[model samples]
Target: MDYLLTCDCGRKHTVSRKQADQLIECSCGQSLRVPTLRGLAKLPPATEGADSPPGDTAASTISKNGENPWSGWRGPCMAAACGGLIVSLAFASWYLLQRVSIDTSYTTEMEIAEGNKIFDLYTPEDMSLVWHSFESLGIGAKEPPLFIRWNRYAEDRARRASIAGGIAAACGIAAAGIWLSSRRRV
Candidate 1:
């Protein structure tokens, strides 16, 4: 269904039967005149798996074995990148929500601690009273058990989100590279 039209510059263009008697531009800036329909039938057919010109569709860039080199992994790599991004967003949102909840809890505890007279004293002499007040309010420990557990869960989610995001970034880069390479080859 296609014919090889060679230009004066020695570049061959694969033209369809419908393009007979039409003018086509070669990559070397030469305008090639396609043969008539009858003349085209005499010309050699465009070889399958031949190197296609730039801007051609993916199907035109098949190799001698009748397979597109980038077809196998390119699609899967992009899909993986998308999947990773979704996972990262889900984990990140969960972590952010948990962080806000933890912050609110901490603020409430701080407000309660601020209401103590020892806190209002604000003097070195009342340091022991401050400690006693904090102990009485159950705020003396470095972190509450509930807060520790929540913080640990949030940290774990954040870590997972970061790892997923990194994987997505890597996959995206790889896919882009493969796409660029395929384009260059074409």
Candidate 2:
């Protein structure tokens, strides 16, 4: 016979006769032991460990023995996926923006010294190409892209973006590994 022992965590568990006098600990995780069937449950055994085999009993995964904070949280379980997405997005965004400025600078420099013979520096976003071309045609006001805006802020932004991307990758990997953990028993 199993007596239901109610724990302070509003959780009740079943105590087998063998485990009764054995100073059975409550599954509620409380650090206290009380003898009684006040608020406990005796839902059959759910594992298939031959010795404790009691047929197939639907055991609650939530009540399993574990100390995971994100045990039942979907966010933590899928954190890796989210982190990977963020890293990819940030990298792509920053790359595109950086490329635009880089291309503009290289081309402008080549055109100034090489005269019309410069690298292909153009983009098809919101007339970025046209603006650059038009601005390049001006006299005395045609400042090279590098000398215009190249400083610590830009480098810092790039570094921070990379750091964020790296963090995201790490998070993604962690989440993936945990999410794919096998439920296959030992």
The whole-model lDDT of each prediction reads 0.66, 0.48
Q: Candidate 1: deviation at residue 142, Å? A: 13
Candidate 2 residue-wise lDDT, 1-186, digit = tens: 444444576555544544433343444445434343432243443233212212112222222343233455644557657767676767757854774454224344554666433323333553676667678875466655553355434565577667766666777776666555523211
Superpose all Cα atoms of candidate 2 onto the true structure and report the RMSD in Å to 1 decimal. Answer: 14.9
Error of 1 at 147 (Å): 4.6
lDDT of 1 by residue, 1-186 (tens): 877777777777777766778776777877777799999998888886444444344345665465676678766766676676666667666665655565424444664676665466678667877678878887644754565576677677667657656765776676677667665554
TM-score of each: 0.43, 0.31
C-alpha-based local distance difference test score of model 1: 0.66
The local lDDT score (0 to 100) that residue 58 gets in candidate 2 is: 22
Which parts of model 1 are misplaced by more than 4 Å?
1-54, 57-67, 97-149, 181-184
TM-score of 2: 0.31
